[model samples]
Target: MRDALVKYGFIAVTVVLFVFFAATEPAFAQSSTMFSMLKFASVTAILGLGVTFTMVVGGLDLSIGATAGLAVQLAAMTMVFYNLTGPTAVAAVLLGGVLVGLANAVLIVVFKIPDLLATLGMMFVIQGAKLIPVSGQSVSSGMVLRDGSVAPGRFTPDFLLIDRGFVGPVPLPVVIMLVLVVVSWFVLSRTSAGRILYAIGANPEAARLAGVRVGLYRGLAYVISGLFASVGGLILVSRIGQGDVNAGASSLLEAVAVALVGTSVLGLARPNAWGTLLGALLVAIVLTGLTMKGFQYYHQDTAKGFVLIVALLFSFTLSRRKVRYTPAT
Candidate 1:
């Protein structure tokens, strides 16, 4: 009974919270409002998946947000500045993602720098470097460039459809998010590669002794993290249709928070894609509810922080209890 509660407590809390919000804010219960909320949450969920992969391998990926920012910026620059085709722009940005992943892998696995510090430094640097291409301006249609010339190209319709187009009433990004979750879950839960990665996270020395290539797997995890972050960025830019400088910065906290929150989900005591999605949904619901209650943007972080703390405590306490009550081998 206790084990079940630890595993399923979030479901109950999520229901209770939904009920409370629905009761307090009628607007939140509307179908359109729900769609909007889900759409907003999808980006965070996507990024959280990437973060979860890194966390599953016992590493942090602080640069995912910046990586995403760079992806969108480069894509926008290709389309609007260089007058490239949509596919070409997308290809360029995806390549950028791979490169960013390689950089993170080199720093962490090759140079042996701490994950937190390496990604953190990359975050600041990439976030700043992104400005150089746009001449420190946001990329929007008809926006004057640094040279006082108007941007000739706009977001192509095909690129815009990546996020905005629907397939049988489902938002594209939501569908993509679901697909990624399935893929991530499949890879992590089913594949030998995924098992080894998890093993390394749990016990690196043991994994190494068992012939696992720890360095290679560690680097691979970071590469995936970087790639997914870029995918998230691509989705966000496709939806918004502009390269807003601070958009990526805002996502960093939400992505990490939701990813960490996933760790305690279902008493799994590890990072998982479903938990990350659930965490993102929980945050989205709370924020939507708060917004209906007239919560200001500046103060919304407090509520988010509180939710994160409660989740951490819940997971930590249950984890300890699980160990205490476990039977000896």
Candidate 2:
């Protein structure tokens, strides 16, 4: 029973909440509502996946939110300031993500800094540096520049389609999120490289002794994380059609929470894309249900905290009990 609880508890809780919401709010079961929930979870899921990569390599990226915010700013600037095309904006944002990831890799892998401290410092740098170009202003269509001239470009319709467009009634973001989940799941759960990452996480010295390039894989993890963050930020700007300075304000908290909750999913106790998706869905469901019940914005955080605590309990408490009592095979 304890083992089952450890493995299925989070999933069970998610289903219960979903059912409760559906029963109490008839609209919650509607296709539109479900899609909307998925859409909202998309960015959280992507960011969580990026964080998962870092976790797999025994590191945590505190700078993902800031990196994503930088993407948002870059994308917005490309279109709204430089009057560039949608494709160009995307290229620029993705490039920015790679650079940030490389910087983080250098800090942690080359400089021998602790992962948390390195990412934390990077987070601060990105948050401040992203503002310098716009002189600390959000990017939007026709915004006035520092030179006292009006910026002329608008978010191209093609760019907005990334957020608003749907494929056979499903939101594009949801589809994108699902695609990322599938690909990441395959990479982490099926491949030798994935196994190497887990090995590194479990024991870097042991992995190094086995002839694995520990630094290389660790650097790769951060790069993957950065790419994921960039995509998340790109989706955000596309959805809002502007670059809000605070675009990623809550992203760090939400991303980290989902990634942590994901560790408890299926009793994996490790970062996995499928678990991250479930975690994101759980958060989205809670937030959407609370909103439908007329709860204020701040209350959503409390609900997320409650869910996370329960997940941790199910993951750690029961697993310990199971290990303590089980007989040797």
Candidate 3:
């Protein structure tokens, strides 16, 4: 009984916070605000879900943030500098992300580097490499008027539409996020690779003894993480309509927080898609509530930090209890 209560405490806290904010802020429950929150959560959820893959394998990829930024830069450069079409630009962006993941995998698995150090070094490399092509300048498309005259300035209908356009009542980026989330969930829960990943995370030696190719699965996890980060980068580009050097700087931190939080929900100590989804929603709600309450941006960061610390404490306490209550052989 005590174990169950402790394990579920975070969910209870999340609900309480939601109710409290909804009561205090008149606009908290408003339809428009709700939609806006969902939009924000959708993006975070996509990125968070990607990170979950790495966490499930008991590995971490600090390069995901930089990978996302690189993807954005690649996409924008393809369109603006290389004069590539949208589809081609997207393909190149995703490919770049996967290649970055491959590099991380090589360093960690083949070269026997620690996951954290390998990914951290790769993060810096990705950051520097992304800046070289654009010379650290934001890339934007040029305008083409109806008369086929190209405007000298760097703003285009295509670029702006990427950020602001929608399909019917749904935002395109949000729809894309949903599709990715569903795909990620399916891959993680219904596939043999997913089971191998969990087994490795739970016990690498045991998984190896069970005939699972630990190195290959670990490498694949990082690749999946990178690919998902690319998807997030594309959505972010669609949201902002341009490539910013600092585009995904906070993504890694947020993704980590979401993955950790997911571990506590439903007693799922390993990464689960639904848990990540809920974790992302929790973050979005907290940020949205703070914004609605007129809190400063810095205060929002502080609040997030506090929330993360509390979640960690709660999860650890519950985990200890579970370990203690397990029957001894």
Candidate 4:
């Protein structure tokens, strides 16, 4: 009972804070504000889910933020330069993300490059590559077709709803986020591949002895991470109606923070979908609360650092208790 409480303490704290804020602030509990929060959560949750994959394989993909940014650039450029439809542009961007993921996998698994160094290098590569098409200019939404003519912006009301439009009472982005959460949960918890990943993270040598293909699984993990980033990038473009070169920079740190928070929740001890969801929600709630209070924006960064520190402390404390209670060898 005490152990369970320790594991879920953060959730309780978040709930309490949310209720308190909703009661105290007039605008905080508005339906529009709630929808906005969910929209923000969707972007961060997608990024966190991707980070979870790399962490499960005992690696980190620092390039996810950059990859997502590059994906947005690719999607926009496709529509602008190649005259591709939205669906086609999205498909091509996702495939590009997968190829980048595969490249990262090769660098780490085949070339013996460290995951951190390899991903960091890939981060720069993607960042620089994203600039090649626009030559450092933000690709205007009003782009010309390949036949040497300006293409007027297509303003389909139904298409706009995918990001900004809502279904009855729920926002479309929120629904998409929920669907992704379920799919990611199934992939990580119910699949044989998922178990293999946990095994690798816990002990790669032991997993190899058990006949698991460590290298292949590690590579696949990166690819999954990149794919998730692509989804996030698409949703982001939809929400803003345009993509920014700097959109992905903040996501890298936010994703890592959310993943680490998941590690501390419910004694999950491994990367988990529900835990990641809760973690992202917690961060969103904190930022919302702080912003509502008119706190300086810079203090939000301090708050994030504090949250991470506390979460790590809680994780270490719980881990020590488990070790101490285990039967003697």
Please name the candidate that would achieve the greatest TM-score relative to the true structure.
2
Q: Estimate each model's TM-score.
A: 0.94, 0.96, 0.89, 0.91
Best by lDDT: 2
Candidate 2 per-residue C-alpha lDDT over 1-329 given as tens digits, one digit per residue, 9 for 90 to 100: 98788888899999999999999999999999999999999999999999989988888899999998999999999999989999999999999999999999998889989888999999999999999998898988888898899998889999989899999999999999999999999999899999998888877888999999999999999999999999999999999889999889789988988888888888887788898899999999999999999999989879999988887787667665321111101
Model 1 weakest 10-residue run by lDDT: 320-329
lDDT of 4 by residue, 1-329 (tens): 65776677767777887898898887888988888888888888888888888888888889999988987777767765555677777788799889889999999999989888999999999999898767676555575544557755442344345678777788888888788888878987899998888778777888999999999999998999999888888887666665577768788999888888887777666678887788888787788888999999999899888877766666666554421111101
Worst 10 residues of 4 by lDDT: 320-329
Ranking by TM-score: 2, 1, 4, 3
Q: After superposition, how far is residue 233 of candidate 1 from its true place, in Å?
A: 0.6
Residue pairs in candidate 3 whose N, alpha carbon or C atoms collide under 3 angstroms:
none
Model 1, CA-based lDDT: 0.85
- The alpha-carbon lDDT assigned to residue 96 of candidate 1 equals 92
Off by over 4 Å in 2: 321-329
Error of 2 at 207 (Å): 0.4
Candidate 4 Cα errors over 4 Å, as ranges:
1-5, 143-159, 321-329
Estimate candidate 3's RMSD in Å: 5.0
